[model samples]
Target: MSRTASDQSLDGLADGSSVVVVSPERIDPDARVRDFDQLSASAQRLFVSEEETNPATAADLDPGDVVRFTDYYRVR
Candidate 1:
């Protein structure tokens, strides 16, 4: 995959970036999604674990999740 400018910044970090590879088949269980409605039902439950209870809020998200989301989705 081609790395965007944002993705490039994460390429060689010391601690390593935490990545959740969401395929068409399945998403990681620990991801905290921003736009839950954009995902399918199964994707929603799997990729958006926090939203199952929190629903549309990002207060409980980790810093990594936010950075990954913005980098991948270009939220900025």
Candidate 2:
């Protein structure tokens, strides 16, 4: 699918930057409202609201808000 502002925003991130993943489904209210890192240490992945998720492609998204997972990484 084509990209959107949110997708472009994420693409602009520096290599190895810490990022919390989110899809187009049921975004964790906590994560959506608060910081992604605020979740528990074990919670490497968090949900994102439809308004917050990127790549605004219907094909990319599931019936509900999608859930994406990724480890937090920082550039050295």
Best by TM-score: 1
Q: Model 2, 1-76: lDDT tens per residue?
A: 1112233345555542223333434254543232334434333221232233322232323222323334221111
Give the Cα lDDT of each candidate: 0.35, 0.31
Q: Give the top-scoring candidate (lDDT).
A: 1
Clashing pairs in 1: none
Q: What is the lDDT of residue 65 in candidate 2?
A: 31
Query: Which regions in candidate 2 have their CA more than 4 angstroms from the true location?
Result: 1-32, 45-76
Estimate the TM-score of every prediction. 0.23, 0.18
Model 2 Cα shift for residue 14 (angstroms) = 31
Whole-structure CA lDDT of model 1: 0.35
Error of 2 at 37 (Å): 1.5
Per-residue error (Å), model 1, residue 15: 16
Clashes of each: 0, 6
- The weakest ten consecutive residues by lDDT in model 2 span 67-76
